[model samples]
Target: MRRLLNDLKIMLLANFWLIPVIALLVGALFYFVAPPPPMHAKMATGAATGGYHAFAERLRDELAKEGFTLELVESRGSLDNLGKLLAGDVGLALVQSGQELTLSERQRGDLFGLGVMYREPVWLFVRTPVTFQRLSDLADLRLAIGSDGSGTQAVIGALLAANRIEEGAYPENWQRIGGSRAANALIAGELDAAFFLGPAENALIQRLAAEPELRLESLNRTRAYLARLPYLSAMEVGEGMLNMPMDTPAKDIVTLGPVATLVANEDFHSSLTPLILEAARKVLENGSLLDPPDSYPAAPPRSLQTLDEAEYYYNKGLPILQRYLPFRIASLADRYIILAIPLLVLLFPLFKAIGPLYQWRIRARIYRWYKHLREIDLQLYKGEWPDDLDAEIERLEQLESEMGRIEVPLSYSNELYQLHVHLRYMIERLRTAQKRRQA
Candidate 1:
């Protein structure tokens, strides 16, 4: 055991060149590898009770399982969320699909689309017995077009403009109020009709659906609206979709609405796209009442530039490593695993040379003695002896003694023994010659 340990120590010392080589390899690995994706990010969600905020909460919970923290910042609504994303106030935001129309070329250039989360239907709830045939019909009645910077207001404005109902033509009683306040006012008869945008399951939408005095109005010109606003999807709401028992709406209703798209600005890390989208997929996997399973988180309609990572995710599932390993481990592996190929390419030749290098190093310890032996042999072959033959033999005797302390691997012990024999032979030859000369 001790001999084996000593051999190992010698072998290790012989490969001292590996230290710097490995150091350089490690430095290159770090220099080439991409920085790990952040484990924390902020999302601009909507009002505390709004659908965007609700979905963001579920998404946050899903990401937490992977040790990622998703901070949800409350905003007024989708338009406000988009503004926050543009200003770089947050890494991500949920914007109503058609809201992209409001962005300038420069503003759109700075943003990227992750995907759509779900639909936000444009709902028009009117007080009972209020005759409403077209959007122009609302010009003479009280209405809630949604608050400023809210998705509700944006969609309603577009619909009204498409009908050629200019803002100046709207009734003086029209207000920019929505959510619970709009639901309450419509119930109290303060407004003849109110426009809201949210999923059927939103608390306010559900509450309003249950009210007997309110009529959930279905539009007749949905095809026209869809033609004008390409980003809007035509959604079907069955008679009892909101509340089957109550038979809310009392008839099937067709409506036009925009999807809620997940947007990120330039400052957002592209690497996190898969992680965020995967978490969102989990949130929408079960599907809602109106949306079918796996229907959403689809690529945001072609109006926006999709992040490359997000596009990869939608085409292929999670990255190979992320599917089997924890996120932190998977992410690190994903970024640096490719580096292994190049590193191996470099190390293969280096390791291949080690064997010969080690052999030369071990053999050098034995071969150096041959130089002295060869010189004495050549001098004797020419019938010449050193001036002081006795002193020359004494010097060779010292070398032979020192050979005992020299160590080489057992595999090369034969060469060492041969060196010993040559040294002894030289000493004996000089001694024999010395006696003859004295006699």
Candidate 2:
């Protein structure tokens, strides 16, 4: 045992360069491997008082439970959010589904999306006694089509342009206001009509429905607008959908808008995609007036490419480990898996190499003693028995005793036995010489 340990120590010291070389290689590998998920995610949501903001807050609160925090940046609306995302200022944003954004190849390359969360409709609410016979007819009247950079204004422009109606250099009666303020203006007779791209649950939409003086216009040209744009979809506010007692929205009101897409920057970490999708399912899967049951999180990403992680989650569900482990732990395992595969392939041979090297080290210790025994036999064969013949015999006997005292592991016991046999032969020759000298 002592001989083997001493030899093993020497072998390792001889190849000490392996230690630092392997460490450097591993360090460089880590630079390319996927990093651990960051603790925080930044998102661009619409107006602070808008539905997008409320949805973002709900999502942020849910993420906190999994040790992930969400940073919400308030903006004018989807257009502003898109600008922030494309600029790399934020990793996530809520973008309205319609409007074929004029993206350069570079911009398009960095755009990806999670699925739609819910539906948002473009409502054209007009004051009482100023009914809409057709969309083109109202272009000459007072209209409030949301403020600049808002999803409402963007969608309204697309709808108008599709209808062959272009904004004049100065449309005399056109006004720009927030959706809620526009609704208020229409109610006070300050505007003839207001355009809003909001979900059914929006406070202004609900408030306007309750007002007797305000009425939702039936954009009877929904099919025409839908034909002109692929992203736009026709929706209807059912009669008495808001309040059965008040019989609000007295009749079916046809409208058009695009779905709300959950978009992420191209470089956003893939691990975070599932978390946000799951959060969306938890927050919106329940049936709302606009959000249908079991409709969120799994739908195709609207107006953008579907994120690969979200596609995996929708198809395979949480990975087997993630289903059992907490999110943080599961995420760690997932990240390591990419590295572990190649690492295992590499380290398996390194570990295998160690066993053979260890065996060689132990065997070398046993062979070294044999070399000494051969040299001693060669010297004694000269038949020289000096006056110190007894002393010479004693020395040979001590050598045999020393050989027996040295320990070897059981697996190498045969080598130890061979060593002892050689020692005995040397001792017999030494004693024979002593006897000859006595004669």
Candidate 3:
């Protein structure tokens, strides 16, 4: 035991920097790579008058109740939101579905899906008497592709380019406007047609439907768009869907577009999954302004965030675990039970073996010295004589004196004492041999 301690002390002194270096590496890895607890997440929302901004404020309030702060950063629209998310300027954002995703290789690492939030219907208001039946029919007409770098612009531009409607092929009236302004422009004859994608209750859509001169274009080419782009779903806006103080649409209007999705970085903590799921449940499970009752987990869905454990639970009708155990116990068990198996498998054996292994190592060192003394004694018994018998006696004496000062456990005390006895006998034999040689 004492020899082991002495060796440990020497090793510590010789390699003192090893422990500090390991500690520093561990600290650095934990600080930079490990996911943080539920924290203040920066979110890039849409323009103040837009639906994205409203959704962001509501989400922020919900997350605040769970000890998280959501900082809302206003952006132009979905395109700008995606840009900020890709740039690492924000942790979360709202992105429109069905838009072709074009990411640089570096930016692809930063992107991941959370889940679909709500659908944004592409409300196409065009002038009456045009008799537009298909998307290609409006190729030569003046159409608003929405403001630059907006979600609407990206979707509309891609759809148009797909049908070979190049920049100059259209009437060349592109208005940079959004919300009510864009709607009013179409109504006032400034724009022949305009596109709006927002909540159903948006005032601009209501006002446009009331105008007798304008008509909502129904793209009966739903099957064609769906065949080409699976993400685009046809939504039915029934008569009287919107009310301008009880003034409603005269007939049913069908539109096609993608849903907006709530997205986060891929490395978003698994622990925060429950909290995010809870927040999503509060906002999404029940019907909102757009979705009817229980119409969520939307069909033919699109999302920037990938499904995880909490999302799976939300989808499966959040069953209560407390029914199987006491409430208090269940809560504690759920939080810590995942760690128990690994701890038992790895640490339990290590702890059980450490004490006995340490004792065995110490005893082995003591037994080795005793073996050397026993060999010398056996040589004398065999009548083997050497000229240096006196020197061998001195060496045995020194070894015995050193062994006497060693500290050993009570269990090994007998073995240590036996070594001392053997050393003494060896010394006596060596002395007798010397005396006989002298005679």
RMSD of 1: 2.0
Ranking by lDDT: 1, 2, 3
Query: Tens-digit lDDT track for model 1 on 1-439?
Result: 9889989988999889899998999899998788888898899998998899889989999999989999999999877888899888999999999788788988888889999999889899998889888988887789999988899988898999998887787778899898889888899989899999999999989998889888888888888888888888899999889987778878999989999999999989898888888888888999998999888788876878988898889899788888898889988887777888889899999999999999999999889988988999998999898889988999999999999999888888999999988899999999988998999
Q: Write the per-residue lDDT of candidate 3 for residues 197-240, one digit (tens) a residue.
A: 77775556667777777877666767777777667678887776
- Can you list the residue pairs that collide in candidate 2? none
- The most accurate candidate by lDDT is 1
Model with the higher lDDT, candidate 1 or 3: 1
- TM-score of each predicted structure versus truth: 0.94, 0.86, 0.64
lDDT of each: 0.89, 0.77, 0.68
lDDT of 2: 0.77
Error of 2 at 193 (Å): 1.2
lDDT minimum window of 10 residues, candidate 1: 294-303
